[model samples]
Target: AKVYYHDFVVQATKVKRLCTTHNTITVNGQFPGPTLEVNDGDTLVVNVVNKARYNVTIHWHGVRQVRSGWADGPEFVTQCPIRPGGSYTYRFTIQGQVGTLWWHAHSSWLRATVYGALVIRPKEGTSYPFPKPKRETPILLGEWWDANPIDVVREATRTGGAPNVSDAYTINGQPGDLYNCSSKDTVIVPIDSGETHLLRVINAALNQELFFTVANHRFTVVGADASYLKPFTTSVIMLGPGQTTDVLISGDQPPARYYMAAEPYQSAQGAPFDNTTTTAILEYKSAPCPAKGISSKPVMPTLPAFNDTATVTAFIQSFRSPNKVDVPTDIDENLFITVGLGLFNCPKNFGSSRCQGPNGTRFTASMNNVSFVLPSNVSILQAYKQGVPGVFTTDFPANPPVQFDYTGNVSRSLWQPVPGTKVYKLKYGSRVQIVLQGTNIQTAENHPIHIHGYDFYILATGFGNFNPQKDTAKFNLVDPPMRNTVGVSVNGWAVIRFVADNPGAWLMHCHLDVHITWGLAVVFLVENGVGELQSLQPPPADLPPC
Candidate 1:
């Protein structure tokens, strides 16, 4: 194992797209930023210098910091933001995780441009479980906005409504030739006639789940969220924000150009979203440019309809562990948490003038009816570590206080969710199972819930409310797929289990930027065990203070 050093200069650089130019905050002046390749047991020491105007902090999206919570970044969850002109170094070792993960700004609206790929290859002298590919490429799917993203979220925050949808979807930070003024910057990938390649596809789009496909090529699913899968072939796959999928693609097509395209897989009815496609080109090696400047039409794959819930469910359920998975079958803690949007009534005498939600109410979301509000002065981790009071409470409900038909109509009185900085306490090394139940309060939507610091086994997923008596029988305990994130289907539920082995505060939330802003989140405070190895390491001397 070795230490890797990187200087992440978060500075503003002018980026032009869609016939408009804006000063976008990026790492090291690269739009998609630099890819960090490291071995499984390597340590990463990334010094993030905040040269941008906004307070910033970078989160290693799927890296389990283990007992080193001081390096787990999530604006005000694990640590305070590095103020403008300030700097902080994230130092942590990637213990057992190996595969494609990513790093991004955990602060408000800033991840719109501040992000990069964190690739974890196998440990030194170790080989991949599958055959080595001829080459590997990182395909980062994203969203693009013509306006300042900060302003877009600010307006939504003030009005209590949905934020403005992005202007276009992006593949490797380019909108491809589908949009005007973008053809010149389309990303191109070259491949030999019959070689195989590994595509590390990541969904970094702020608010939408994307469907990705390649013209005249099929993908064999090999891994996801850094965990190896059973390797099944498919034509299309969907990825929610913060999720990564590893697929092997063969260059078995004719010697021609093909378009790799991505669009949204929005399941929420009445939801506003970008309906455009982003693409990149896959050209045969040494393929010449079209003669006489007349370009041939690139072949485009048939993506699923924007609202195809069945397709999304089928793709998600197709994942399976290649071998026996270690799941905590005898759960120590069982919790049922409901997640969805809710509406808060306008204040008395306000007459709905300031509210912009359903029936003139403010929009919000929650887990177990508690809307997670972050502490401003210090992070939950810092407060818990130093015994600081009034920062957060550890009484986050283990189950919904009231029971009802989660996927059906509920009483209007249950529409408002209480907001607080609440966390669930867990004993280190305890096995736990959480039934993430999605509701139809405001509208049923697929919420990609990402849990930091641990990869959990997705035991089972099905539509409508979960019935332990029925669903328990359908659990795939032997070969459940492991992941750091799982998309809770619309009007449905998913069961995930993990050991509370990492002591520290870990934030679990919806990866959709808009849903997170509406308070769809929770924190888990796992108490330290007896020895230093099981407890959090001492805070670094240079740890940023609030």
Candidate 2:
């Protein structure tokens, strides 16, 4: 494979669309950023130059950093931000991964404007489990905030409450029809009567899990998070924040314009804050007898409700064995943890003393009571360079003291942080299992927990609390969806197992951009094997200095 080296300038550009205009930041001047096509095993050197006003860093989401943690970009977590006018080159090789992944800005709120799809095809002789499509199109779903994203966050931090909702949800950088008044509005897709199209859908929304569907077409979900799944067909699909689903649509139907729509899936507690759904028009080509006007009565297929707990549970179960691809079962290490929201006394400057949260108390989520705070002096990469053994605690609780109570009054609960949480220690090549329990406090928000490096098997998940006896009996030891991230359902807990074969400092944290910014993160250190990973060669001279 050829070595891929590229330079990108992250700058703000004024783009005019749908008769309105706004200044948005882009990489190399492209609104949707740039497409990076590479093959398995190929090395990539991406020099990112920050010309925009905000500090930034680009993270290769879902890629196992494996001794290259410096390139794992999560501001403060992995490395310091590349200051404005500064530059940083991310150097790493694609190893054992051949599918769709993505890259995005990892600094505060910058990712809202900066992101692109990273496509990795298999090496020369490798074949896909399903037949390859004639053409592939990336369909990225994002949230559009009319106000400056930085300002939105700043106001939220100052108000001590939920920030204002976004103006519209976007598809490939365009807000389809919903925000006609907004400058970033996009024209919807026009489909031919009998066309089959591949839609590589990515949910980059900061906090919501979306249910996606076209008016009448059936979608076959084939791949997710850079890995192909055992193909499955569904009318409507649910995608959590930070998750990706590749679907195939067969437009074999009457020619008529229909709306492609996405809405928040119901949470365990109740409907989303805003019940309005985002809509995109899908125009099917005219037939021999052209209709006079667009059909507003196109069939709206039955989709799961935003808070259909049963369906969500079943869908999650179906992703486990033997209905899915086989996963290696022998675990090398087992780590258990409890995740919950706790209250902290906000200093006088931030807000009022009495804040509303779970149980009426001000709340913040944590991994086993200890919210992992990013030290101002340490970068996630610098910590790895200094070694991971001492940077994180290894004593996280094996089991939680209290499971969530969906119907209980969380607002009145008194909460405190868990001290001395344990971190996991593993040798390279050790198989591992991690159980995460959720404590119900305030609201039951979905936690899309993402891990760097290796994909793991989701063993099981349950509500109320985890019953060790019953849950263990139902564990799927065979086929499971090999994913780098899994959603910890509201008021529920999940168990995941994987192999610690990749060496480096990896981060495991909530995919919710807001939660991660507030510090729901941890590091996984995989010790090096004899010698080093073959891909760990020195970077070339003249690399961009960021």
Best candidate (score: TM-score): 1
Candidate 1 accuracy as lDDT: 0.89
The models' CA-based lDDT, in order, is 0.89, 0.69
Write candidate 2's Cα lDDT for 365-478 as tens digits.
577566676545456445555554555565545444444443245543434654332345567777778877666754457788989777887777777666677788777666
For every model shown, what is its TM-score relative to the native structure? 0.97, 0.87
lDDT of 1 at 211: 89
Q: Residue 368, candidate 1: how far off, in angstroms?
A: 0.6
Best-performing candidate as measured by lDDT: 1
Candidate 1, 135-195: lDDT as tens digits: 9999999988999898999988888777888988899999988788988888888788789
Error of 2 at 412 (Å): 6.3
- What is candidate 2's local distance difference test score? 0.69
Worst 10 residues of 2 by lDDT: 534-543
Model 2 misses residue 413 by how many Å? 6.4
